[model samples]
Target: MSAGGRGGVRATLSGLTTRGRSFLAAGIAAAVCAYVLGQDDLLRVGLLLAALPLLCAAVLHRTRHRVTAERGLAPARVPATGEARVRLRVDNVSRLPTGLLMLQDRVPYVLGPRPRFVLDRVEPGGHREVSYRVRSDLRGRYRLGPLQVRLSDPFGMCELTRSFSAYDTLTVLPRVEPLPPVRFGGEALGHGDGRQRSLALAGEDDVIPRGYRHGDDLRRVHWRSTAKHGELMVRREEQPRRSRCTVLLDTRAAAYEGAGPGSAFEWAVSGAASVVAHLLERGFSVRLLTDFGVTVSGEGGSGHERAAAAALMMDTLAVIDHSDGADLAGAYDVLRDGHDGLLVAFLGDLDGGQAASVARMRRRGGAVAFVLDPDAWTREPTAVPEPNAPLPQRLRVLREGGWTALGVPRGASLEELWRQADRERPGPAALSGKARG
Candidate 1:
């Protein structure tokens, strides 16, 4: 509602307390019996009973006491399944003291149970603070609330409810598990070499002009840079590149199987988040992108800024949804554009065409693959595997294509897989380059 005052007398009267309603009901019955029995005493009692609640209602409706609420969330951004505290402060601004306050906060069921608080009383011109903890397993942004409080009259015959308009948002980031760090064969180059390679990927606006050569094309001359340098300068046809590590996640609905948190898709997202965090902490410039080409990039930083960037990345990963793309064509182009960088991909099931498309990106840079094991995915979550074959052929396909690939089980720990990856040697083509195979 716009304001408590907006609820007119009719609305206010509708808030008649349970006691009030019962008393009124009893009074009506008594009056009816009195009429049939012709009893004057009963009639007089009935009149008094019926009048009391009405009088209380009228008294409550006339109250001009004003209430205001302020809400706050501590550590508003939390990881999935993490807890956050919500503090709500309510004030009585009117001249009259409040009778009682029954406070309840509105929240979604996913965020756990609603919190209710009881305050004995609040003096006029005074305020009280109450707090509750909320936890959610799901990742997304959730609103905490406009606080609603029930105010009662002294006799308890009537009560009114008022709601504060203020709302607070809590961001639940995807769970980013810490992973052990390991050197990658295609992860980095000599600092100078990497920088030079990065320039080749620069955008037009990032053009760094150089002294014009004898064979330089006139069309390539950078007019602005020439004026600034006071000499003929030609645009360096280098592709601008700063991203050192790219984490590609397959969001195509067809690529993944199952639903919910225990599914391969969710496991992949969580693992991707972990890998992104590990890279950021290691001072690597990172980029996270979906197969559909949606991307989020963060500059390399080790302090407060790193935390902020991680939050940004986590926020994006938290809300990412499955895509409708049938193939990895969008991602293929993205992966094939970088050089002297590390490309880490978390993919679902891959057919021959998809695997071939993914493999072709290896020539542009080193690649690491996390593929879901079809055998594990086809089984129930509670089913135990009997050490049977787990799609060795698919993993072999990616390995032969020069990727350091590992098969991920539906409910397996990513940290364990990271250890396994570090123990294994990369393909010969990994340290150098890969031709389409």
Candidate 2:
């Protein structure tokens, strides 16, 4: 017998329905009673009662079932608080007709409950299609799939569950808002030490072939190019200049307050997303950096490279979570290693160490920070003075270290914040002048 037929037999034997079990128990009891009392009538009734289950088991044992499923998503990727429609198509590929079948498409709890349906029957070589909608306010990659179909006997005496091991991934990206162009002071950024240049040079080099230089290896000659140019042309190992922007998002859980979408961490993530989008749109190679110094997305190239990089960055931001393990200062050490055109940070209330790290990043390029007031986001108001105390002290430290720092409320709009940072002065004076009352 075929594997599917053997599987069906095994499933029929193992998956005895409630009614089937009850009938079998009644048959056994009746048979025992009839044997003890020498009653032929009871024995005949027991045999009749037991015949239904035996027939069901035998029918299922010989049945073979096979199905194929395909799943499609209307929009596979979406922003936070977006919805998508999932369409499922199931096809019966067996020669025998399938009995009553139930279908369930599993989904993540964040999206919604699993969608379930019941079908009376699917004829041989027949098909059925179903669709459902899923929505989530949270951001992350979700799997929608592995169609579970339960095949049962006509009388519901036995059931066999078969899983179609197919899955589709839906990526829920972070909410990216538009930001006004903000200028970074022309501090001499590290020239030609960009991530893209290094990666392109070592891994996938995209270069032109020029005339062979002194002591150039014969193997380095581009034969095709040499033939075209009618001269010995060797691959040029020059680093092309591409503007770089590093967006630092603070992810230390202790640094932010509140929970869920309205939390300071989420605000920072949104702000970072906006900054990343704005930079990439302006033709700057952007890299997303976290307090843990994790490089979620590295510098992008022009055109398709930039677009792919931006998409990956937005997807990365969707699932970014706060980390409390890495020291803020230690993480900032990554900033000193490379030169970036612009360093924009979305930060929460910072301690002295964290503030000092921000200061260190100023040397890399034009450092600008959008610092959020954590106390305002908390349930209970803190005693620390907002404008006259802690916020001002932190701003002073960052400004003194040569950073343009803007203090923002938890509920401030990122666009407005970016515009203000663009026109505002650097240092504690800017905070005092633009500090919200």
Candidate 3:
């Protein structure tokens, strides 16, 4: 027999039910006894028994049918604790009808359980679709796929399994909080690193359109221009001086207290995500800077561009991990040359030098910093602090350098802190004023 034929036979035999195996074993014993005793009736019985299992195997091998599976993830992207649906479709394309089919799609433990489904039978050219819901409490890009389909005979004598190689991805983003609008202040933020700029109006000349780019929003299409030009055309994008904001996150493993998902590092990450979402919503072009480097950025003042950029930002944050670097110099480097309109950072513990660097990192624009308190996040709870103690001396340095710095203690509300930073003021006061405990 050919290799394929031999493999088919092996697969056929491997699918044998216990009862089929027992019948085959009994048939072999009966045939041996008959030969020894020279009994015709026993020999006939042995031949009949031996043929039964062989017939079943032949039936299973002869009618090989192909099944196909397709998986779909609804909303493909979701935030932590947000739910999404998964739809699965199976089709039987062969000429012959298929027996019972058991379907199971693999999923990550964080998403809950693996969903299993069953089909009574599939006629020739038949199809079936099933769906399940999955949700996760932590952020990450996870795979849910390679549908496993088990084909079984009605008599339970044989079974075969086929798995689809295709897989679908589901991205779970960090917990994003809807922040209240907050106005900030600093020196006149001259457009330094603007991504979008409005075209200077010269009456009718300014209305002249350009060919649509790949990321251009269809809403901006100028049909009149397209008809005149005999090709697709869109309004000229704004000038490259739109307001910009940089959301920095401290990801150094040694900077935060404790470990795992509950560490101060994770808290900083989530807070940074919230700030990014808020800035984009407020029509500011936003970029995510980390201790490691730039994670992602969103450009343009238009809704379409911001939406696409936001998606990319969240996807990047979903899989972000801690950095081994001991310093937050990456953030400084990313902002060194650019004068961002706003600098919002979620930082972990900082010594005097790093704190000074962070303070000078933003050359111009409104700067807000949330410094995580390492004492509160220690693996073991330490002694409680006095009710009216002042914050760390680094924060004073930050205040002197014109950064709106606040200490993030355990159970602190980010929204409240954001509101506090919104008020613009200089040192020696709480909230909008100088450094306070």
The TM-score leader among the candidates is 3
Across 1-437, the per-residue lDDT of candidate 1 in tens digits comes to 12254477788778888999988888888999999999999999998899888887775665434777778899899998899999888787777777777899998888988999988777888989999999988788888877788887777988888776778889888888888867664333212234344354446667777899998899989898888889999977754334478889998898777776667888888899999988887767788988987788886664887788788899898888899999888877776676457778899888877887887766545578899865588687788876646456667877877877898876788888887876774755545545533
Q: Model 2, range 1-437, lDDT digits (tens) per residue?
A: 11232364455777779998888889888988999999999999888778878777776555434666678898999888888999877676778777787889889998999999888777888988889999887778899877787777898887766676778888887778876655564312223443333323543235577798889989777777888889998876556565677888888877787777767788888889878877777767777888777886655555787688888898889878878754566456787776646778888878777687677676545678888877667745454455555877888888877677888875778888777776664644443343321
Candidate 3 per-residue lDDT over residues 141-237, each given as its tens digit? 9998777877777766677666667888999899887788766642223234434444646554467688988988999898888888899998775
Task: Report, for every candidate in turn, its global Cα lDDT versus the true structure.
Answer: 0.78, 0.74, 0.76
Q: Give the CA lDDT, 0 to 100, for residue 64 in model 3.
A: 49
> Candidate 2, which segments miss by more than 4 Å at Cα?
1-11, 26-48, 61-64, 185-240, 296-300, 380-389, 425-437
- Higher-scoring candidate on TM-score, 1 or 2: 1
Candidate 3 accuracy as lDDT? 0.76
Ranking according to TM-score, highest score first: 3, 1, 2
List pairs with backbone clashes in candidate 2: none
lDDT for 52 (candidate 2): 79
Ranked by lDDT, top first? 1, 3, 2
In model 1, which runs have C-alpha deviations exceeding 4 angstroms?
1-6, 21-52, 62-65, 186-243, 302-304, 381-390, 427-433
What's the C-alpha lDDT at position 253 in model 1?
A: 90
